[model samples]
Target chain A: MNPSDDAGRSGVSRRSVLGGGAAVAVAVPLAAGGAQAAPAAEAASVEPVTVKVTVNGEPVTVRVDPRVTLLDTLREELALTGTKKGCDRGQCGACTVHVDGRRVLSCLTLAVTVDKREVTTIEGLARGDRLHPMQQAFIERDGLQCGFCTPGQVMSAVGMVQEGHARSDDEIRERMSGNICRCGCYPSIVAAISDAQKVMR
Target chain B: MRAYTFTQPRAVREAVTQAGTDTAFLAGGTTLVDLMKLDVMTPARVVDINRLPLRGIKLDRDGLHIGALERMSDVAADRNVRRDYPMIAQALQLSASAQLRNMASIGGNLLQRTRCGYFRDVSTPCNKREPGTGCAALTGINRTHAILGTSDACVATHPSDLAVALVALGTHVHLVSGRGTRTVPLDGFYALPGSTPDVENVLRPGELITGITVPRSMWAANSVYLKIRDRQSYEFALTSAAVAIEWRGRTIRSARIAAGGVGTKPWRLPAVERALTGRPATPDVFESAVRTAADGARPLPHNGFKPALLRRTLVRALTVLAESR
Candidate 1:
């Protein structure tokens, strides 16, 4: 979660992910009918599972708890936090990531099951300092409110655009129904993704 | 959440051997992992059977054999499944979110647990979870309870949309146990909630579902899956039906219809199928067929709207089929 390495250029300060409510909520009650009263370290005692993931363009090996979700591993272990943790119950699209180039909810997926498979997180979407076109559109259209759910939204939008799925506003709405925005920022979000889709096409 | 042991078994024999000792088989882990995270299922050992080559999709002499490990997404996109068995493909595609469909397997989908609030809670007294504990779903906040298969003990409906379509297809299941291999009609695999709601399936100890065998049929080519719920997507069916038809020129030769979100198991409507066979494909035929299909269907206090909704969905589905025919 330390963004000190590339903060200045992205204009995202370390304070966004550290020493704030954003960092605190990650450890609080995860969701309704969910446990928010534990630490990620406590989950480590369960089992030290080792799995090799062919992530994006590279193969990376990590040891984690057997209970660790793919979403948690991306954010906590690899610092690939572009996959958001909206509802964390597979109900929301904020945790959307790609497994072998197909969209999947990272929160509902287990790291153990993704072994030796190609996983694309939001972190790998951009080429070096170049922003992913979808990310650029979000900025251009102001497609965010609190920004907690932006990363997951951006990742999902990237998947839809790359797949040529957003043929119309209705199609976009149906495809994006999996993700929810409490701030009612869907209009702008859809606009941003649609604009990006035009460019990607 | 106690710790559990994990074993990756590459063969069926190795998995069956471990299944004898309180082990749960892991396929896609979509539903199982969610339940486990909620502390609903705490198995002592988990047998990861993904290494086995059970992810098959093919058409042969006997029928279609779909491997147990085949993901829902793969099945939905399969050429044969889409072209021939439209109901199966549409049902699989209509379930859950895109990510879930990608991770959920056919076998796992068939065996998914009920989405009942009581069954999911560790603190709740569910007959399915702990036999003789009594069901809280009987009269307590039973909005999503089943009406077709209800006893005083339980009322929760089975939660797979794809299984309903498979039932309409008259699919048979292949199981591999330590003793040997055997096949059972999918309709008979699930048991009613009469006295032992806990024993939901007839699966013997150490028996693993190998694949699904859907017999070759002329009806498969003209099929549809219709799901109706509170929301447009990612929600369980309120009253859904899977329809497949065989046509003799302008007349319907045979029909396969089943209901979901309204039964203890995926319910095959014999009455409806009987009505459709040998009748000319028409709007009147569709209406009468749906009426007979749900005849004598009992509705609970909350789910009474389903019988009517089911009929409408069937009419709409049959009309679609008629046009296509």
Candidate 2:
């Protein structure tokens, strides 16, 4: 059976859906298990562009389908799952990461666009065992419950402080509005950011 | 998202030349990528124009020239935009979230599609998304549908707060294509949803927006953008007013006003502007002038409150502008 037929039923084919770095990990196992194998003709049809990106101070080269997003590349490809994907759409800030020193929704950022740019994920914040001020502040303030949104919240707070918008509690709440803590940890999150701001400065 | 070949053009000329009927110029990727994932927009060729040098904010003797590729947050934070064009700055600040504002470009923000639920869901019928497909929002849940500019075909509102401020300040959009360059007033750039609801803008296929110019004026410095939404932040407006007033002594010399979340396009209110000109800047004048806000408004079943809301929002904006100065 052609993979396109599966796409006809599901609106997306496995061959076309494997744009994330996790594609290699997921595809090889399935192929070895003899579950399904993408035909060489279908595989050769896609043109993967090579991109040289600096992620977390490490220089890396990745060849990805143009459709792959930065969030998928980090989580699935590079296995840097520290940056969580809450909503694949840009609505949720769980996929937030710093591209070129600015906080942006990695889910909406195409991997090709980040070529030759510096991307700092949540994993990059700590130096060795010493946590970034924001990370330590979140722990002290009990800023997280389930901690799914912690990485994005911390990353966004760091960027927000660097942008000089985290001056007051009200301002911190307004600036940190993007990262939604579904566990209702907004007060703690705001407190954490406020605490981190002084130390980070 | 659909599979498509992507190209990064170093020059604007090369980017324009690469454009075709089935090609899309990617910027920001907020609206385009979101829509593409829903299969609403399926372009065969995707052109990444991020590498182009269209990112700058310059003010000359003419006016404020904002490059098309400038990010929303960067433009909002620019000294000139914050100091001279407060309405533009406030609009950008109030739109989306911090993350989106950082990623979204000014050029793509103007061309963002409507927030109509019917248009977003491919399962539903939207004349704007698919022409000849009957509009589900016409008789469905349309509490957020447009009231000022409603046609039988579509009733979706234009979702840009910045465009409303830009239109009120008399901004001109700079466009460039393989054919050449031409400038169009931002007010006239958007097409009304009449017979062809699918055709949103006047851009010819492959045409690109280079920059926008807002003519410097004393009134713009006193401008204010007042948006009333269900939520206090991170939501599209139920009714929004962008008002700029030029005061001469106690009376108004000139007034520039535009409304959002009530029309198919950023609506300039010349009638309201006429009511304020040469009149004393008072609460009475603002209330009476704002009454004409819903003069020709055609309200749907659920959106009957918009006209009243538009009037109140405009009055509040005018009052705020009057009081602030």
Candidate 3:
């Protein structure tokens, strides 16, 4: 089977459990089908580890395979699909997220390492109807086309502003180079970030 | 990725004890995890050392002590590092992406593997990956291979921008384990790709890098790192230079230089430094000194342009440093 198909098979959505809407530390039981498409013997022999992490704001305890990345965990287990997966490798920043208020590539981060740490994804950036200033600026500046890379760009832009390096266009371009825009929305993205950085400052 | 048992060690001693023959230490996970996914490195046990208390960045009488666990972005943004060692800051800023910089640690950056496609692709034969398999890049598409310090077994270039800068400034890598502690110069830390390209470094089985110490010098504050890559940002270097020079009036007092993207390891240009040691900082002197920058280069078929590019990059870096100060 193809790898993408395996990734989809791992997606046993936990949306219903998460929609409970309280910051409670809920321990969800692991499903047999939630395991990766490894050999039957290997899957049975391998043990899953328990991870206690705070996503968005709610504390979540999940039993996942040791090798599962935070990107897959966020997309498949938690059903926070806003954080796209452009390249599973670290080459693309599509899976960028804030771990302890610092931006990091979720694709390269193992879920177990984020145990007891706070995670912020693209879904967490909005508050009710009023969106984040950066998100609103992205919409006003027409910063996206296909919208595949928008989540990562917005998250990275927010992080760049927090890092205090959004001083100039060149600096912004350099700092934001991690997230690739396949649709080439860099000009509009820069404009959007420029607009948002002022308010963010 | 193959199945592995993961454990988080609370202390350095615990982390060291958990490491074994088929085990890997996970920090940042930028290099190790990427390779694990590619199947190039398969470890049965993974020891996560993120919680180890090794994050320290300070300048003392011994020089700048940078903890191995310190993230790349934090080290680059440190006020003292920016003010005293601009080359280190520039190298760190110009590396991977901002997100990667936030995740990658200083020690992990030094141990990053080469970006050679042949080395990365498991289908192809790569001596560096699997010894005795023979090198695919020796005759295949090798436009980005090393032009210096290459052997018949391998031609992949070293991939760290921060390493070139640290080597130029006389840095030492500190290591620790259950056995004891030892220090090695950054220059001698890397092993040449003579016949055994798989043995990259001199680290023992369970030795963990604790930190690095960069020697304090007058030239460090005036130093700079210049990287010429395929693109303007977020790419590996095609040809890069890290230069630090101390001047006596208009004449050069001491000079240290190292090059990247053209050598199996961070290539030090002592001949070029010797040529410029007592000369006046001028265009003619720079042009003449850089002539020896690529002294014993052995360029492959596709990477023949690297020798010339290395010389030009060095001259440009020196010119920029001379004018800035």
Q: Which structure is stronger by DockQ: 2 or 3?
A: 3
Task: For residues A74-119, write the lDDT of model 3, one tens digit per residue.
Answer: 7667777778888888887888999999999998998889999999
Docking class of 2: acceptable
Per-residue lDDT of model 1, residues B1-325, tens digit only: 4456677788889888878656678887878777877777777777888898897899886778899999997888788889888899999878887667767888888889999999988798999888899887766777677878767778889889999988999899999989999999999999988878877888996689989999889898899999988989778998888999898999999999999888888988988899889999888888877886566566776777877888898898888888877
* Residue-wise C-alpha lDDT for candidate 3, range B1-325, written one tens digit per residue: 7777778888999999988778888999999988988888988889899999998999987799999999999999999999999999999999999999999999999999999999999999999999999999988999988988899999999999999999999999999888988999999999999999988889888789999999999899989999999999989999999999998988999999999989899998899989999899999999999998888899888978988899899999999999998
Better of 1 and 3 by lDDT: 3
Worst 10 residues of 1 chain A by lDDT: A21-30
Best by lDDT: 3
- Candidate 2 matches the true fold with a TM-score of 0.92
Error of 3 at A177 (Å): 0.6
Query: By summed lDDT, which 10 consecutive residues of candidate 1 chain B come out lowest?
Result: B292-301
DockQ (C-alpha based) per candidate is 0.36, 0.34, 0.53
Q: Cα RMSD (Å) between model 3 and the true structure?
A: 4.7
List, residue by residue over A1-201, the lDDT tens digit for candidate 2.
665477788866543454532223322111100112235454346587887888888887778777777887776677778898887778879989999999999988888899899999987888966999999999999999999999999999999999999999989887888888899999999899899999988
Candidate 2 wrong stretches, greater than 4 Å = A1-44
